[model samples]
Target: MSAPDPKTPDDDPLVTQARLRRERHERWLREGDMSIGRRLAQIGVLGWIFVAPTLAGLFIGRWLDARHGTGIFWSAPLMLLGLCLGGWSAWKWMNSR
Candidate 1:
């Protein structure tokens, strides 16, 4: 009798499915356009990215004011700085591929 044909796991149906999925992902990356869900997720991420630093600055400034017995002097400046920095960061992130 003839011998059986040799085959690798790459020939399996599961492997074929996985390969197709990977190809689709690569195509999506190349196209650089995402679905609405992805856009919404990106917005959420960007919002957090902008808000985190502002919140952190506010907390730190508040702590400093409490420790130094100062008014909103420190807090106001720091908060504004944080706002500018966050805006800059978010802008860069949005522009990046």
Candidate 2:
């Protein structure tokens, strides 16, 4: 890249300064995007997302099991498995993004 025209700075000094600051801040944020707390929160959120269906199944299955007498025989477990699969899928999706 060509050196900055120090003699005249950029065509717009304020715009240049803002651009430089934004780049620097982005670098800093990227460097620290994931800390222990952040990681824990991420895990918590992912778990919640994954388990939502499971919990819903538990309730709905229980209700249906009582109404239909199936005991949610498969829904609960299936939903639990979905939790893990959902998390894995999310990871894959994020990586692709």
Candidate 3:
């Protein structure tokens, strides 16, 4: 293999400055990607807020079933409905934002 040539005037200060600025601009474009963890946390908070009441109702119904053992099943559909509605709301909110 041949030895490489020494640096030339093509490597002048103005050229170097332009190259540095281009690199910085590209770096910013790469780093501007959204954080998946942050998005997931926002969705989780949405789900929690929307689903809390249904889950609480489920729990209370289950507790009441300590006497009858039937109210618990009655709450299952509510839980599922809550999950669907909450997920829809979360997706809508995220997409809107």
For lDDT, the strongest prediction is 1
Two-way lDDT contest, 1 vs 3, winner: 1
TM-score of 1: 0.65
Better of 1 and 3 by TM-score: 1
lDDT of 2 at 35: 77
Tens-digit lDDT string for candidate 3 (1-97): 9999877766788888888789878987988866899888886788686787568756665666766777567577666776676667767776665
In terms of lDDT, the poorest run of 10 residues in model 3 is 57-66
Largest TM-score belongs to which candidate? 1
TM-score, each model?
A: 0.65, 0.47, 0.41
Residues 24-91 of candidate 1 have per-residue lDDT tens digits of 89999899777899999999999988998898888889999999999886798888888888999999
Q: Between 1 and 2, whose lDDT is larger? A: 1
Tell me the whole-model lDDT of each prediction, alpha carbons only: 0.89, 0.71, 0.73
Query: Where is model 2 more than 4 Å wrong at Cα?
Result: 1-30, 74-89, 92-97
User: What RMSD, rounded to one decimal, does every model reach?
Assistant: 10.5, 10.6, 13.8
TM-score of 3: 0.41
